[model samples]
Target: MKKKIVALTAIAVLSVGTAAQAAASSVHTVQSGDTLWSISKDNNVSVEELQAWNELDSTLIYPSQDLKVEDKVETYVVVKGDSLYKIATKHNISVDDLMNWNNISSDLIFPGEEFVLQGTKASTTNKTAQKATAPVSAPASAPVQKAPSAPVAVKAPASSTAGKEMTVTATAYTAYCAGCSGTTATGIDLRANPNQKVIAVDPSVIPLGSRVWVEGYGEAIAGDTGGAIKGNIIDLFMENKQDALNWGRQTVTIKILD
Candidate 1:
């Protein structure tokens, strides 16, 4: 009887230990080139859940970092052009209610930040997934023909990056042009650095804020957009008209960096 009791106790302890080990295995190690969306998909978890568990401020992650893949919680992603008031209004809740729920002391919120939204988590998950897998837009056409001194911009050549790229013509524009506002589609103010290496790309072709290398243009950000800069077309920002003219119309390779 004594031997049997000891054996049973040992079995109970072993089972509990195994359960704990199984729980710990829920963690996932981050790998190179892993985006939050990709990580969530692989783990069968949602991006909001990952953000909540890890308290992540942005979607950015580094290799060797560990992330929680289980224990999901309800959450919402704040997209671009969102304000507390705007979000509250869209959710049919009051701004004060939002602040209370999020434990936020101010009205400030940023893109990629997750919040615990009340009600209908399923809807939130679907919406988040849609955004994560949204297709890249086709490259824009050549920038509008401006003065002779303006740089001719063209679309960068295609590469094997996740986001597709296409060769298109390009034109150069100055942020300080007459009656022009220097704001980018991604909210970068070109007036702050007129000489900054930035390109106005259609948000669908190249995501805003993506770091890209323009052939002969060095490294530049796909930050701004132009009315004529649709479908494989891009407008490179130049410091002056003379520099723009010097760069008029050239085929170049665009490589999206990881």
Candidate 2:
């Protein structure tokens, strides 16, 4: 009876050890050219969740990073000329959110970097999807004409229920034309900077948290405004004097989309 008791105890210990091992070894395979964005899209997971799961500093990933969780992660093959930013936009998510999801600290992603996306594919990418698709007003034959010049003396939009003050959080990187003394930046240069956080918002018209779909630029939440950008005015950031001049002031209609 003593021997049988000892044997049973040993078996119990072994079973517990097996269970612990299983809990610790939820591994995921790496595929060719897999990026965190693609994997997140396929698996229906946010890039943020993936990052938390793996404790990544940036979006950088390598082949065959073993995931310890039993949750399902989707995978995608990387194509040549792919970028993390573009991939994030394509999936309708912010770059920062994607980075956080994958526990990544850098923007570098190579082919076959496996990542786990959380949730059903549809819900994860819906927020970043473009809301306004109205064709930009331009000349009949010219290649996208400039917006109409700002009214000489800008008139404020109709006043709503006594200007209520509300707090808004940063949903995405918003553009600003704060530097009025320099040339404006082109589209490519405008969207490249990561440090720029200045947002050009029209206060009375767009209340806080109201998502504003800019004409030339993509979607941006109405988060903040500059001293000079009060009322109907907007100040978009420019790289240099040349860019500002090139993208001269135009009448851009701010569509309040959600």
Candidate 3:
């Protein structure tokens, strides 16, 4: 009877070990300032798996957080002033999914939390991109000279190849508030609000934080605008006060820098 009991205990231990190995294809040791998003990106696992395995609540995962690597894992330590968003971007995982996995109740997180890695899948869009069409403008009060044809020799960034070019396009729009940004080439002065942060932009072609030069408007950063600006265009913030007023109707070519 004694021998039989010992044998049963050994079998139970082995079963548990096998189960653990099956559930986690890889294991990651948390370093200082590790977040779930970072771990997921580093490894090829989804954020949901990270949460389900680690049982996290709140989007916050701290340094020294031990995480299961779904596949190949290279351990990384978290740095200071790291936020979940930055980490998610670094790892390429959705912040929402990261939060859900960790059972994170609040955004609150401190340094030194430990966790596992999750990964993101590539995005595939089903809808075809619509080509931009020229909109009819109100009759000008004064006669205006026709601008020269767009230059054929002008080189464009490789990113813009994703969409067809519009003869005329809406570069930016006014956002009265979140979900309230007005559209159209209404001739709002762009220089009125100077030094504003970028609200939105086309991530594929015109990356955020890129400085651009406009033919008519001088130098400006690709900053602030509506959801419609996504894809191949950019939005520039005007200086405050009369800046928006000074922006009159004009056509210009935009050049992006390296």
Top-scoring candidate (lDDT): 1
Give the lowest summed-lDDT range of ten residues in model 1: 1-10
Q: In model 2, which runs have C-alpha deviations exceeding 4 angstroms?
A: 1-89, 92-198
- For candidate 3, the 10 contiguous residues with the lowest summed lDDT are 1-10
Q: What is the alpha-carbon lDDT of model 3 when measured against the actual structure?
A: 0.37
TM-score of each predicted structure versus truth: 0.38, 0.29, 0.27
Residues 64-174 of candidate 3 have per-residue lDDT tens digits of 455554433221122234455655556676555544434334444333232223322111101211223322221223222332321212122223331222222333333
Model 1, range 42-124, lDDT digits (tens) per residue?
34344455677899986667777877655332344554445666666666876655555555554445544555455322122
* Candidates arranged by TM-score, highest first: 1, 2, 3
Task: Give the C-alpha miss distance for residue 48 in model 1, angstroms.
Answer: 13
Best by TM-score: 1
lDDT of 3 at 183: 24
Q: What's the lDDT of the predicted structure labeled candidate 2? A: 0.38
Segments in model 1 whose C-alpha atoms lie over 4 Å from true places: 1-165
Summarize candidate 2's per-residue lDDT along 1-258 as a digit string, tens digits.
000101000000011112212343344454444444334433433345556788977656665555323233232322223355655656676555555445445455543233324323212221221213221221223122122221222112112421223333221222333343221111112334433323346546564333344555444434344444556665544445565566666665444433
State which candidate, 2 or 3, has the greater lDDT. 2
True-vs-predicted CA distance for residue 53, candidate 3, Å: 30
Cα-based lDDT at residue 59, candidate 2:
59
Residue 191 lDDT in model 1?
71
lDDT on C-alpha atoms for all candidate structures? 0.52, 0.38, 0.37
Each prediction's RMSD over C-alphas, in Å, is: 24.0, 22.3, 24.5
